[model samples]
Every structure is written in structure tokens, then in C-alpha cells.
Target: MLPLWQLTVAEAAAAMDRGDMSAVDLCEAYLARIGALNDGLGAFLTVSADLARIQAAQADARRAAGERGPLLGIPYALKDLFVTAGLRTTAGSRMLADYVPPYDATVYRRLQVAGAVLLGKLNMDEFAMGSSNEFSAYGAVRNPWDRERVAGGSSGGSAAAVAAGLCAFSLGTDTGGSIRLPASFCGVTGFKPSYGRVSRYGMVAFASSLDQAGTLTRTARDAALVMGAIAGQDPLDATSADKVVEGYAAGLSGRLDGLRVGLAIPEAGDAEQAQLLTDARRILEAAGATVEDVRATADEALIVPTYVVLVTAEASANLARYDGIRYGHHVPGDDLAAMLGAGRGQGFGAEVRRRILMGTYVLASGYQDAYYGQACRVRELVRRRLEATLSPEGGLDLIVGPTTAGPAFPLGAKLTDPVAMYRNDIYTIPANLAGLPAISVPAGFSAGPAGPLPLGLQIVGRRWAEATVLRAADAFQARDDSWRRRPVMATSAASA
Candidate 1:
């Protein structure tokens, strides 16, 4: 018998296509693996074993009846932020622990239409507020490679599950660097489509303008398969692009032989980050790709500060609906005011409360221009600069750099310092700010002064250019078989 736990989505699909594996069988195998491993990792908030089996059986029937899609029968998981009708969709906050959505988000609905079998909901930082996944009310997700290290966040669970072979692939939302960062830490492939390329209608709003949904998978090819099924126009989402959804999977077979790859020269041998970028350039060049030195503009460096303003402002507004009155957590109190205050005060985590306060303060009467408004203008400038540099005449297929400043630090490494945690997103923030397609693929493992940990190289492209990004990523990985290796988690008790 084939080791179902070792199968990739593509491999599983081929098995199902050849009748060697049934969708129901694949789903059951995954559910068994998840059951065996998730308790140790805490990667999931909920497991839909029964539901998944039913969906898988239905997929088998469909395939039997000559119906199939690229992802049909593939068992996947969703970051809890994607609201699923009747399924408990907790955004890893106590506020929504028992709250069930009356409807599915467009992404969930579309995946269902694609005949994808959903295994369950994964954990995330509360309201997608933190980078460590430590802020989740459900507890942090442990890295599959090393249980002692975090799996990264807010999409940590999605990435962890895929990395651990618990799911074929998974969907995660990226605002700031949620998807790509987690994928980097977990040593998986994460693709964040150009903003608006995928519908955010059902995705819980974090930073609306910066929020995007993408896939965390084992390979760039698998990311393309999932992206193909999920990307398109939705009448419900005005922000969703109606542009052509080409065959992203087909584009993966294409090469970067004549393509130009941009290597952003970090200031001097700041050796830490500089070395990671240098290694990335070497891999890309070895794959028959051309490289050019490109400097990150001044606006790019301002992404961290700009993101704070825009994300907090939008989060504050988007989170306003969580008062005790509606569907979320409600505190039974003497009066309406007491109820709302108590519910919000107790339900929201410290980081969430902090951002909400900062957001409200910046958008308040006198501070708008000095803060939020100024941030928007800066964001616009940064976007324009990226567009100019990546235009056809700019001679760049994708921009390459380190995914994070470095690898996963020991737990509590940056917990006390918010700015330290924020700086971790430095290499990733520009993509979200510019509204472009970007991905983080495992480059290789690096041994720093401390110890060895995985490294990631980012490939960013112009808007709606996921194809180019994935192609280059695939090329780099092909040039290095070592990047495809998985981490071996030591024998340790799963974190509760």
C-alpha cells in the first residue's frame, strides 16, 4: 500500500484518478494522521472528520461519474478566519469560540464547488493580530519540524498542517506577512496572490485593503493548483478583480531561461540578511536565470510604519461589529453598555486591544493626517515605485530576497518587545503594501551562531503575476533538491 501520509496533493490526485485511491480513502487517511499528530502540535482549532469523509465520498462518486477538477477530492484545511457555514469558525479568539457563521465565505463556497474536501479549521492569532501565533486563545501551534519552535502565524496552523503531511494543502489569509511568514518558518511554499486577485468576501477582515487569501502547499506547483481553483471574480466582492484567470498550473511548466530576476542589494555585509539574499541569488542564477542589482526605494523601508497605520485603522473599523449585541461572545450584564464593555474587554486579547486603541487614536479627529492619511500617501508612493520598477520595460520577472530577517527564534524571544516582532516582517511587508503577488519558498537550512534553522527566499512579481512568481520559485527549488527536504520533529510531548 502507498503511504498516504507521504502523498502530496498532486500525487493523491493521480492515485484517485487511477482508482488506486478513493477520495474517501484519502480523506480518512488524512483524518487519521491529523488525529495522531495534531494534539501534539495544536495546529487545529476544530476537526471535521465526519464531514470530510462525506465530502470525500461525494468526490469519489463525482469522479466515478466523469466529473473532476484539479483539486477534486483533495483534503484541505482552512485558517479559522475563513468563515464556514455551520462550522465553528473561531478566529483563534475566545470572542468567537462558539460562534458559527450562518453562511460560508466566498472562498469556502468556491472550494466546495471545486470538490475539495475540507478536514477542519486551523488555529490563528486572535483576529490575525500577532506574528507569533502565541496570541491565539487556542494556544500556539508548534512547528512540525521542531515542536519547541513556533510554527509562525497568523496562518501558522495552515502551514504546519501541510508541512506535517496532515493535509494535502491549506488556505491562509495574508495581511502583513501571515501566509508567507508561516510558510517560511514551516519550510513550505506559500503564495500570496496580488491583492484583489482572490475574493476576500468571506475572509474575516483584518486589514481589508491589505488582506489576501492564498495557498500554503508543499510545492509551487501545488500552490498553483489551489490558486487556480480559488482565483476569480465574485459578484459579492467588489474588490475582486475580473481579470483573466489564466492557467497558473500551466505556467509552472514554463521556464525562467530568459527571465530577469531582481536581487535587492541590502546595505553592506550586514551579513545576517545579506547572506540569505546572496544564497538566493546563487540558486536563481544556477537555474539558467539572469540577475540584476536593484535597490529598495526609500518608501519600501517605510512599510513597517505604514502598515501599522493602515492595518490598525482598518482593523479597528472592521472589528467594530464584535459588540455583545450581535452574534459574538456576549457577557450577561446589568445593562447594554455593561454587556458590550465586559464582552469586548474580556473576549479580546491584549494585542488585539492594543491595535484597536492605536487605530482609534490615529483616526481620531486631529491625528488623521499626521498618522493615517500620511501613511496612505506613503503607501501610494511605494506602490507606484514598485510598479515602475516591475513594469515590462523594467526587465524583471520577479524580485528576490530573504523572507524574514532570519529564522524562528526561541519562544518568548520577541514576546516582550512589540517592535522586535514587527521588524520580523520587514522583508515581507513591502509585498502587501504594494498589492503584488509574492511567495516564500524554502531556500535551505542555515546554521547561525545559535543553531541550524530553515531559511526562505521570497519571489515577488507585478500584480496578477502569480505565474511568474511560482515559475521562478519552482526553478530555484529544482536547482536545489535540498530545499525539498522536510524537518524531522524530535520526540516530545505535543504542546497543549
Candidate 2:
């Protein structure tokens, strides 16, 4: 039998419903696992043991009182980007290291209302800036598959936590592939909803237009369950869409009959990743879906540069508020302006500073049209092309591709070369740019120098088509059980 800590959110909820285990039992098991593994993994920045216990107790009481919820009593954690009222909400930077939010993010509040237990905050890239977890002020998050490799980021810790069974699920934000990249590296299920599908009122902003709240879970079904709980329009977030939330969990058929799936052939990619894409096509075809090859587009190359420009500009505007006055780390200086510069210089990590500087330059009056404005135009073109390809009248039902160019690389491999590091997000950034729903499902494993590392297959759907994406992912996962294979580190942690 699988240990409680290893169970998926859906599995644990069923177990609790069957009276096979109590909420408290589930919580304690996870806490024990986190305690044993977090020191080595650096997955969690804060483990709210006392608060988790209280939430677990409350969940138990709710279950006893005949109040049933899909997420009731299930343990989860958040990327430190989400502001939790009393819990420390560090955006993986010293700037907000000591800052405690006075209000809860709408997503977290919704999960709490669903009776889920919060274990604490997970680590992330500073201000959600970097492609790898290396930029975190708390120290880099080590991949569970191979300790020396990266877990992927800026949501690396969220993915690592779920992969290591520290939590049944975790909330993460995806701004240019943060959630999906890490999920691919860590071999977990990651789902980034269509922009505005979930409220981002209390989430730390990286890029206002691109950043979206998402989930990292053990399986696609688990993601559906969590999404159903937290996804909806919120008054707090004006950008949140007012569309009716669908019954995502109930809609997962795990059968892709008649679904038109497109295999996005990446441009002369690594051989292993190309094979993974071919393998994914076979699985979908075997499961009764029609598959076709999609030739790479010119706009594909524009994703990274366009994303960098737009996000950095937004980031510059958003981060300007953190100038030693309102909250976060403060450094006293001779005057107000000097103090602001001193505080930001001391508080932000190197990656954050770099992006801020780039953003400021791109948004400057002289370069705005040449860079930022042009990037926005390219972004719109990319979105239009993707929309046409996924349109029901003339195109495919879904698009599939390798989540990353390759598996998790060595920890310091791309640190010095920021371009190489940014390239890591190449395949996963399109959906974010287009404001579409996408998921990264563990497809298979690739042998690494240290050991076997997981590779992911990405499934993308039209805007607001999360149900379709989840169905395809669930069907693929159901057909291929490769996702069931756990890392050796995870196995050792479960036993310990």
C-alpha cells in the first residue's frame, strides 16, 4: 500500500471519505515527511506546523459535521509568492523576507474554504524572476530526481514539494513557464489555467498581464479538483473573468475519442525531446485521437524575447512600489531617494535587479516603441496564430509538444549564461503569451548522468478550455502509467 504522504489529493480525499484515515492522520503523515525531507530539498521556506495542525483540526470538525468537500482535509502548500495573512509571504527575495501579509490571496482563501490544510509556504525564484531556482535568497531548491540538478523555476519549490510528497498539491504562479517547467523537471502534473481563470489579487506580481495562479499536483485529476475549488471570478481582482466556472473534475473522461490533437514539431530540437514528442503522439493516437503534425512557425522564435520585454516592463512598474517605504526590507540613508536606492539594492537578488534594469530601459521613452511596443505587437500576432490553429471551425482540438527542450540540467549549468537559462522556458512560454490553458504531464523518464530524470509532454487548449486540456492529459496519463514511477529520492523519503 502506498503511504499516506504519497497519496494524491484525490486519493487522500477518497480515503478520508471512506473513513480509512482521518484528516489529522493525513496532515501528520505529510508533516512528518516534510520534516524529514525539506532540509535536503529546500522545497519549503516555511513549514507552518502549528497553523497546519489547527487547520487540520478544523477540517476534521467540518467533516464530522457532515460538510463534505473534494479538498476537505487534503494537505497543500503555496509558492511564497502568494500572500498569506499571518504566514510569512516571501517572494523568494530578501525584499519581502520579513514581510507578513495582512490579507490572504483569493486562491488560498478559496482553498481554505474548501477545507484544505495549509502546510506552509514553499520557496521560489526571487520576485518570481528566474528560470532556475538558483536566484532564490533562501538558497537553491535541489531536484528530488537528482540532488545536484535544478527543480525548475520560478515555481521550482512548488513542483519539488509535490514531487517529494511534502504536500498532496501546491499552488504556484506561472509567468513565462514557471509552473509547467518545474512540473516537467520534477515529474509532477502542472496546470496553468487561462489568464484570469483564477484570481490573482494577492499573488506577488512578476508580470501583470502574464502571471497566473496555477497548481502543481501528483496527477491531472488532482489538478482538476484543486482548480474546481479555487478557479472563479473574484471581485478583488478586476482582471479576473466573469465566466461561469465549470465542473472540471466531473468532466474528466480519461478518453480522447474524436479529439483532434496536433503534434507541434519543435524546430530542430534535441533528439531525446523529439523522441518524447513522437512517443506522446503514439499514445494519443492509440487512445483513439486523430493526430497531425504542426510545422513550427516563425512566431515561435519570438516567444522568449517578446515575453522578456513585456514581462520586464510590467515587472519594473510593479516592483517600483518596493522602494523602502511601504513594506519589506528597509535601509536607512541620508535622504529619501538615497534610502530607496540602498534598500532595493540590498533587498533584491541579482536576477531581480537585472530584470528590473532591463525593464526600465525597455520602457524608457526612447526605446519604448522599438522594444516594448513592438514586443506587444508580436505577442498579439503569436496569440492570433495560436488561436487560428486551435480554432474549432478549421483547426485542431489541442496542441501537444515536449514541455522542455530537455530534462533537468545540472544546478549551476546555465547560471552564468542567462540566455541559456531563459532558453529553458522556450517550449512552455507560448501558452502564457497567448493567454491559453496548458498542462505539463509526466510522459516518461530520460537517463541522466546521476540517474533517470523525468520528461514532460505539454498539452495546450484554446483560451478557457481547461476542461479539454485536462481531459486530454488525463487520457494520456491513463494510457501511459509512466507518471506512476517515483524518483529514488522520493522512495527513500517515504520509507524514512
Candidate 3:
């Protein structure tokens, strides 16, 4: 059996059910792992050890009472953006560094009901603005594979935590590519459901339309199990879909016969990436699935620009509530304008402030029509184009491609180049723009100077077809073991 902390969500759950370990035992194992590894990973912003123990005890009690919940006794963490009643929720920003939510996020509430233990809060980019996670006010989350490389943005800590075995899995929010990018870099499975499939209530709003809650886990099956707990209609969130949730894990029939996987654009990066694609194709084809190139007519170049304009405009509105006059980091001044200005200037990090300014500019009177409006139109076009491409009539079951241009880059390599950093998300932004369900599974790895850096193959399905996405990823993972690779940090922590 694997170490308690290193077990996947499903494995740990089954272990506890077999009486091999108790909920408290599992929780303690994860807490100990986090204690040993979090300092170097920067994956967790707050370790709720006491809360975890309490929850673990409760889960044990429930299990003793014969409540057979899938997540019962399993330990996991949330990106700091998720609100936890009575727990500090920082959103990786000074603006809410000391803020404790009075209510729990809908997703967190559901997971709690499922009997999952809350290990802690994971770090993220402040206000979910950056692509490399360096904009995290708390600090950058280092790649577990290579300590000097980034773990990808926004959900960096979520992926890093899972990769380092700090937690079994972590919840992350993806606006553009936050969850998938980090998952790809960290060599974990990242699953982003179709927009509105999962409730966003109680989460710190980034770009409301684009923001979707997802998971980072060691395997696609773990992601499926977690999604089962978190995905459903929410009365609190009007945007949440009213569709019924499928038995995601059960949907993994392991039958890929006649499946049509489309090769999406941006081509491949290096020979390593190209080889990864070729291997992925071979694997899919060997499974009785057909892999073919998809000729997309929409200008892929507009995806990033359109996403930036729309999300920034939404961010400008969402973050306006953080004015110090209410709550947050306050800076006093003689006048109202000065007070608001000073407080925001000091509260938000550079990236957040820059985004706010750019968002504000786009939404301004005359510029609104030219930038934000056009972006919205383009977003609609992207949605229609993608939907059309994935329609049953289009003969494409899923879209497949590399999640990132390459493996994780060294930290600070693209910090000064926002364009390059933004481009890193080029392969991923289209999904969020089109509100499709996407999963990034560990494709393989490329040798870097420091260690083996992972690559990812993304599977994007029709909107609200998270079941298909998970099932396909599950099939691929069953055929390969790349998803099982652990980084040096995790291995060292296990030995320790």
C-alpha cells in the first residue's frame, strides 16, 4: 500500500473503509506531510491543523455509524480564495490577509457533508490575476520537480500541494488556465469542469463568467471522485447549472472504441512535446480511439486578447468591493478619494493593480465599445465556434492538445515579460473562453537541468460533459503511468 499521505483520494477512502486506517490516522498523516514539506513548497497559506483533527474525528464517528461517503475521512485543502467559515481566507492577497469568512463556500460545504477533512488553505495568485503565480502576495509556489521552476499560476499552491504530497488533492479556481497550467507543471491531474457546472458561491469572484472551480489530484479518477462531491446545482449561485450530476467515476467504462479525439492547434513546442503528442496519439489509437487533426477556422490569436479584455473588465467590477472603507487593508487619508486610492494602492499587489488599471481603462466610456464590447463579441464567437466544433454532428468526441507550450520554466524567467507569461496560457485560454470542460493529465516528462519536468495532454469535451472528460482521461491514465510520477520533494518527505 502507498503511504497515507501519498495515496490518491479513492485509495485513501478505500483504505479507511477497510479499517486499515482511521480518518484521524489519514488526517494526521497528511498534516505531518504538510508540516514537513509546505515551508519549501509555499503550497499552503494556512494549516488548519486543529480544524483538520476535529473534522477527522467527526468523519471517523460518521464512518463508525456506517456512513459510506466517498470522501469520508479523506484529507484535502482549498485554494485560499475559497471561503471557510471562521477560517482565514486570504485569496493570496494582503487585501484579505486577516479576513475570516462568516460563511462557507458552497463547494466546501458539500465536501464537508461528504466527510472530507480540511487540511488547510492553499496559496494562489492575488485575486487570480497572474499566470506564473509570482503575483501571489504570499510568495511563489515552487515547482516540486525543480525547486527553481514555477508551479504555474493562481492555483500553483493547489497543484504544488498535491505534487509534493502535502495533501491528497486540492481545489482550485480556473479563470483562464490557473488550474490546468499548474497541474501540467506539477505533473498532476487537473480537471476544470464546464463553466457553471460547479457552483461558485462563496468563492472570491475573479471573472464571474470565466471562473470555474476544479481540482488538482494525483490521478483522473481522484479528480472524478472530487468532482462528484463538488459538482451540482446551487441555489446560492444563479450561474450554476440545473443539470443532473453523473456518476463520474462510474462513467469510466474503459471503453474507448470508436472515440474521436481531435488534435487542437498551437501545434507542438519542442521535439519533446511533439513526441509526447505522438505517444498520446498512439495510446489513444491503441485503445480503439481515433486521433485526428481538427481544422479550426476561428482565429485562435484572438482568444488571449478577448479573454484579457473580458476578464479584466469583470475583475475591475468584482474587486471594487474591496475598498478599505468597509473591510480589508485600510489606509487613512483626509479625503474620500485619497483614502480609497491609498488603501487600494497599498492593498493590491503590482499585478492586481495593473489589471485593475487595465480593466478600468477598457470599461471606460468611449473605449468600452472598442475593447470590452468587442472582446465580449469575440468571446461569443469563440464559444459558438468551439461548441460547433464539438457538436455531435461535428464528429469530435473531445479536443486534445498540450496544456502548456512546454514544461515548467524557471521562476522569474517570464516575470518581467507579461506577454510571454500570457502566451503560456494560449493553449488553455480557449476552454475557459468557451466554457468547456477540460482536463490536463500528465503526458510525460522532459529532462531539465535540475530534474524531470512534466508535460500535459489536455482533453476538452462538450460543455457540461465533465463525465466524458473524466472518462477519457481515466482511460488514458489506465494505459499509462506518467500520472504516478512523484517529485523529489514528495519522495524525500515520504522517506522522512
Quick one: best lDDT, which candidate?
A: 2
RMSD of 2: 1.3
lDDT of 1 by residue, 298-390 (tens): 233587899999989999999999996777888998888888989998889888998999999999999999999999999998888888888
Number of residue pairs clashing in candidate 1, backbone atoms closer than 3 angstroms, sequence gap of 3 or more or interchain = 1
lDDT (CA) for every model shown? 0.84, 0.90, 0.89
Error of 3 at 413 (Å): 0.9
Q: List the residue pairs that clash in candidate 3.
A: none
How many pairs of residues collide in model 3?
0
In candidate 1, the residue pairs with backbone N, CA or C atoms under 3 Å apart (3 or more residues apart, or in different chains) clash, namely 40-494
Q: Which lDDT tens digits does candidate 3 get at residues 120-224?
A: 999899988887889988899999898899999889999999998888889999999999999999999999999999999999998998999999999989998
After superposition, the stretches of candidate 1 with alpha carbons farther than 4 Å from their true spots are 268-275, 297-301, 448-452, 490-496
Q: How accurate is candidate 3 locally (lDDT)?
A: 0.89
Stretches of candidate 3 off by over 4 Å are: 296-300, 490-496
Measured with C-alpha atoms, the lDDT of residue 9 in candidate 3 is 88
